[model samples]
Target: MSQHESRWSLAHTGNRILLAVIAGALIACLCGGTDLPVATQLVILLGVGGVTYALVTLLHRTRR
Candidate 1:
């Protein structure tokens, strides 16, 4: 129905942001050269995710 189409067309910002964060962390993990300890890996993911979220936010702001 047109109602469903309208709802689907309106993107939910929060989900998009979470996806961006996860994608950033995943890309970082895949591209990292060094084999770090589990704890270090967690830290790396956190750092990359934070940076990615910031960049995404900046980009989204600029696009608006």
Candidate 2:
């Protein structure tokens, strides 16, 4: 594989793990009986995390 592709693959793996952890945290908070307001905040966090993950992945792919 080319140098750039290898770098991107590493980055993508790390980002995927980070995103998964964020999602897991959201789920855990909801399951823990957090109140509506706090649960809503966790939902927002999930959304932002998803978007950021997507953007970074796209940018990495485009650089190849």
Candidate 3:
């Protein structure tokens, strides 16, 4: 692929990862400072992150 395409792909991936990390942190906060189950919280966080990433990618692509 061309340099531009590669850059765009990298940008998209970076955005997804950044958003996912933020979402995970938010989820961790929502879980509170307790020693309880974490799997569910993690799943929810990941789901939200994935959706956000997808929407962002779509918007970026369309705007181009």
Candidate 4:
């Protein structure tokens, strides 16, 4: 595929991964993540996911 298409694909994959990770984490929390460690881990997961998603999106946009 072309470079642009490749970038789009990468961004799409990143977005899917981000969503899946967040969803799974939330579900876990609902199931039994009622501890300080779980809460802290959730915060870290969210922060990392957010940054990675943003970076992937930015990369796609800048390449365009």
Candidate 5:
């Protein structure tokens, strides 16, 4: 495998995806992309992000 591929582990990829999700959500909120209130949006974002992180962590551990 290429050095780049070896260095880019599953855990790292998962983190990047999580970060992207958070950034996108923030952008959407700031841009008024949704009708929901800011507090509601934040709550939804946290719930989704928490579940996604848990799933990623579980998969990473199982692969070991």
Candidate 6:
């Protein structure tokens, strides 16, 4: 494998922004004392992450 391909990165600005949004959501849930069950929270987070990944890829390709 190439050295560049082997490294981990959130190299795009869109990716970094999505990461911050995920973190902010977690903090808000914690501070606001949300009553979401563990399973529900996990599903919601995974859904958000999946959608973010898809949107970033879609937007990045068009911009390129």
Error of 3 at 62 (Å): 0.7
Residue 54 in candidate 4 has what lDDT? Answer: 70
Model 2 C-alpha RMSD vs. true structure (Å) is 5.2
Candidate 2 Cα errors over 4 Å, as ranges: 1-10, 16-36
lDDT of 4 by residue, 14-38 (tens): 6556665776566556646456576
- TM-scores for candidates 1 onward, in order: 0.58, 0.52, 0.61, 0.52, 0.57, 0.54
Expressed as tens digits, the lDDT of each residue in 1-64 for candidate 5 is: 6445444565687564766477557655664676878777777766666666667778878986
Per-residue error (Å), model 2, residue 16: 5.4
Please identify model 3 stretches exceeding 4 Å from their true place.
1-12, 33-36
Candidate 3, 9-62: lDDT as tens digits: 526688567876787678767776666567767777778778777777777678
Give the Å error, residue 21, model 5: 4.2
| Clash number by candidate, in order | 0, 0, 0, 0, 0, 0
* Worst 10 contiguous positions by lDDT, candidate 3: 1-10
- The 10 consecutive residues of candidate 4 with the worst lDDT sum are 2-11
* Model 5 CA deviation exceeding 4 Å by range: 1-5, 12-32
Greater lDDT among 2 and 3 belongs to 3
Clashes of 6: 0
Better of 1 and 6 by TM-score: 1
What TM-score does structure 6 among the candidates reach? 0.54
Q: Give the Cα-based TM-score of candidate 1 against the true structure.
A: 0.58
lDDT of each: 0.66, 0.65, 0.71, 0.64, 0.66, 0.62
Which rank order by lDDT, best down to worst? 3, 5, 1, 2, 4, 6
> 1-64, model 1: which lDDT tens digit per residue?
4434233221456755686678767866775767767677777777777776677667767765
Q: Give me the runs in candidate 6 sitting further than 4 Å from their true place.
A: 1-32
